[model samples]
Target: MRSAIWVGAILATLAIASMFLLDPSLWFAPERNTLIVQTFVAAVVAAQLTLVTAMPLAMIISSLRNRTKTPLPTYIVTVCECGAVFKSKPMFCSRCGRRLQEPQTKQAV
Candidate 1:
């Protein structure tokens, strides 16, 4: 679906570019009112196509962004038998060499 929209946009750009390149006098020709009107209609159609394609593209991008998950923060603290406070949990107390208690896990609010 996205590829189709891109192809349509590229084709519209090429058509508009070719229109101007093929007839530089179309803009200044007073006798070619019908050609000028056709050009304006084509431009309006191209703009509408762009707007229609952009809406779904924007929605897809926003949905993709919303689907991503952010990592949660963790907090750990341990107190040893010797009254030593440590910010991180360890296998044993640094001063007493005793096995440390299980670390408590806290969830962020």
Candidate 2:
């Protein structure tokens, strides 16, 4: 949300500059001192836009990782699962090819 706001603010500033066709002399009033200020502000605005675009992309990738899962039911299986399909009826790790402790067996015994 904050990144989005930063992007909006930067775009608004650019629009303002283009709308007014802001004269460079105004910034340099008397001694053309606005050169340094203009360069610094431009750099800051570009960096902000870059971050604003990058953060949302990162958020999307993290949200799309549907295969990710955490193995907490057993101590023998790997802890963090990145890409694997889990089934309850068969009780097996498809990626590692290991059988999980059958719940039915535990109940029966």
Candidate 3:
């Protein structure tokens, strides 16, 4: 989607440039001068608008994609040294009244 918007903006810019490069007389022709200028201005404006709108949209889409990719643990279980099991963390062990330490995660080799 972002690529398509970029392509459209590029094409609009190229179209404006081509008008001048392809026909230099369009600028000098009195009757067609106003129409050619207007067309050039419109194309430039359209390209600018496309880029302006695309930036925020691209940022939003990227943020949403990153947000959905993260996975959160549903539940955590902790075990105390005194053979006490807890569904939730506690400051002290219920069985031994000892300060409970955070469980260490074992890394895979």
User: Against the true structure, whose lDDT is highest?
Assistant: 3
Of the pair 1 and 2, which is ahead by TM-score?
1
Give the Cα error of residue 25 in candidate 3, in Å. Answer: 14
> What is the clash tally of candidate 1?
0
The residue pairs in collision within model 2 are: none
Give the Cα error of residue 33 in candidate 3, in Å. 2.0
> What lDDT would each prediction earn against the true structure?
0.69, 0.55, 0.71
Candidate 1 per-residue lDDT over residues 8-57, each given as its tens digit: 56665676568778989766777566765565566556666777878899
Candidate 2 lDDT by residue in tens digits, 51-83:
878988989988878448553453232321334
Best by the TM-score measure = 1
Model 1 scores a C-alpha lDDT of: 0.69
Q: How many clashing pairs does model 3 include?
A: 0
Estimate the TM-score for candidate 1.
Answer: 0.41
When summed lDDT is taken over every stretch of 10 residues in candidate 1, the lowest stretch is: 100-109
Q: Could you tell me the TM-score of candidate 3?
A: 0.40
Model 2, position 83: C-alpha lDDT score: 41
